[model samples]
Target: MADVAAKERRILVAVDEGDESMHALSWCLSNLISENSKDALLLLYVKPPRAVYSTLDGTGYLFSSDIMAAMDRHGYDVAESVLEKAKRMCKDLHDVKVESIIEDGDPRDVICQMTQRLGVDVLVMGSRGYGLIKRAFLGSVSNHCAQNVKCPVLIVKKPKSTVANN
Candidate 1:
């Protein structure tokens, strides 16, 4: 491949703080580098929506504002931890410009929006994640992202289990 410009290609890596996601991040670092330049790596952690309920006539709703706040806080912390761990694992990335973002919304939707807004050329994400049940029924983040996002999407997965293969 020819040399690429540092700013030309933007890569967005979506992680859900799952160990499986680390493989995706590592894949991005190892594959996306240019011979004469480097590209931007954006780490995004999506915070699930907070429940909100109103009390009417002493009836309680399944909602909590504090829950939302906590989710946001946790998301930020996860983003910070992600960057720190990335640095620890891939020290060479120290010179490459990177951005850590924590956003609140549906993982698939937010990822798609970020890709469009940032003009991302490549998206690296995990095949499976923290919410296995939701993903199984609603659609996995990797599956949704592959179907919706315009850019190329890479789905990282652990080695298959022998039991499953048999």
Candidate 2:
């Protein structure tokens, strides 16, 4: 078991437009903190790649078309909203600092790249996400990330909902 007295470790949490992301963020904020003091958290939101390609004539590539651009903007908006909620929850916790980043690409690749570039010590993310269709086709992002990143990855399963509500 890891010692609780260890120094603060950098944590990277992947966020997407989904309930799983929200649950993971909440769990990280509440559970992971510096033993000595506050620790920094980097939240990342990755947008799905757009359908664009290069021309056979070698003219240029068409990327981020009007529709894709709009979707990208929407993704940023969602990320910002999630960050705002996270900040609100952290108001009482002085030992945690949060930062948010939005990027566009394959989530697995982007997460691994960010982890390497940011020097992340731990990764906290949801085991399952809202991209069921994509997952069925492309495999789970968490799975790919777990296989690729060097650091330890924490995969949180969603809390089971009560049947009494129904």
Writing each residue's lDDT as its tens digit, candidate 1 over 122-163 gives 998889864565464446778888999998998878565522
lDDT of candidate 1 at residue 157, scale 0 to 100: 81
- For model 1, the run of ten residues with the poorest summed lDDT: 51-60
Native-referenced Cα lDDT, model 2:
0.70
TM-score for each model: 0.75, 0.77
For candidate 1, the TM-score is 0.75
- Tell me, by TM-score, which candidate is best: 2
* lDDT string, candidate 2, 9-92, tens digits: 778888776677767877776577643445777888776564311222143354447745675576667768866765665566
